[model samples]
Target: MLLPMSIQAKSYGWGFKKNTNHQPPDVGVYKNILDDLGGYYLDNSGDKVVYLTFDNGYEEGYTGKVLDVLKEKKVPATFFVTGHYVEDQEQLVKRMVNEGHIVGNHSYHHPDFTKLSKAKMKEELESLEEAVAKITDQKEMQYVRPPRGTFNKQSIQWANELGYTHVFWSLAFVDWNTDSQKGWKKAYQQVMDQIHPGAVILLHTVSKDNAEALAYMIDDLRKQGYSFRSLDDLVMKDILPEPIIGF
Candidate 1:
């Protein structure tokens, strides 16, 4: 679905048509606003590479396994964590940083930024940053994946003005709901079926299926000649027109 055309406060849940052709899903009309305000959905290159990311709203007891899989696979990823996650699971957040992964801001209260004033948005980000700073070595939060995948031009603009880059996803599935999981094999198949070049994949840490299928996914993807990269690499690519995707 398209985001509201106006520049006012309108909440938009991020979505796109699912593709099974190993290509980036068309983001419809979000291309313009994202391109104009530094939002990234996927890498613009056709190389066989992917960026792994997770949204941690609350712990479902699988992040440790997810981290273990990443450690075993030596794949660097970014975990966008909320305030509750940080406050509740400090060591896990610390482990994310100590293990060479990025800890992105998923906001403090996990509220809709479009409905919030710029100052409230800043407060939300900074509060999470401060909470994370006390527990992890990473002090400044440079990336933001909006709560519930919702945003607008004003929200993106405010984030940019606050020295943050908005990151959307090019590859995702219906894996967030814990009540109706489709099993690990289904999750694996979903990713493998929709896999593509330079895809910014969005997965939830709350998914037991994701944690179970992560290592296998990494191995099989590598077997397909794809290399996993970090969000740092993605951001650098955005800043410089080098060999990065999503230009």
Candidate 2:
């Protein structure tokens, strides 16, 4: 059976317009797709709250600093980590959990789940879950962010069957490129200009630019009357009930 045309696999590109009074049309479209599939991209609660998330595929000498900023600011955020990150950065992962932050599963090897069979996909998720559990003392892993922001109906369904909620970001920029660091000023402008209520913001833990601007970003966002939220507090309460398969 095929997914509904609205929920079919498509490369998720995070984008939005600046100085808008209403939710961007594209955001609404993506939100509906995730809503139908029991997933989430944006919070859309009309509150001045934003959910912060970081993708930690591997350590790049900046996660510690990022965590430091988060701790200093006392803002809760989620870290979606891979097997390599968990194995190599056990201390960092420990700190994340110890400091009241959520550690989410980003798969074992960071493969595009859309290209894998159901069993392979399960292994990818389960292996990472097992690693996180071992490190966090078997804390239940519930959130899954598809590597490279890619997914499909089958993969999402398989994840939900295993009691995982898929998370995609609603706001991200070209900060992943290490060679082309956009400087802290550009990073600050991009994030602050696009700030919106109930937005799921994605930042790479490896970006030095993000590290430099994180504290300032938090302060500026707060100045603008925005607050930070944890994904557990945001998505879990908003998830829709599982839809019947083969509709």
Task: Give the winner by lDDT.
Answer: 1
Alpha-carbon TM-score of each model against the true structure: 0.94, 0.87
Worst 10 contiguous positions by lDDT, candidate 2: 238-247
Winner by TM-score: 1
Off by over 4 Å in 2: 1-25, 239-247
Model 2: which residue pairs collide?
Answer: none
Instruction: Give the per-residue lDDT digits (tens) of candidate 2, residues 1-247.
Output: 5656565545454344444343532654556557677877777667777889999988779998998998898899989999999999999998999998999889999998877877998899899888887877547888999988777666777789889999887778888888888788888887877677777888998889999999999998888787887887675445654421110
Residue 180 of candidate 1: its Cα lDDT? Answer: 82
Instruction: Give per-residue lDDT, candidate 1, residue 213.
Output: 93
lDDT over C-alpha atoms for residue 98 of model 1: 99
In model 1, which runs have C-alpha deviations exceeding 4 angstroms?
A: 1-5, 240-247
* Candidate 1 local distance difference test against the native: 0.89
Instruction: Give the TM-score comparing model 2 with the true structure, all chains together.
Output: 0.87
Q: Give all candidates' CA lDDT scores.
A: 0.89, 0.80
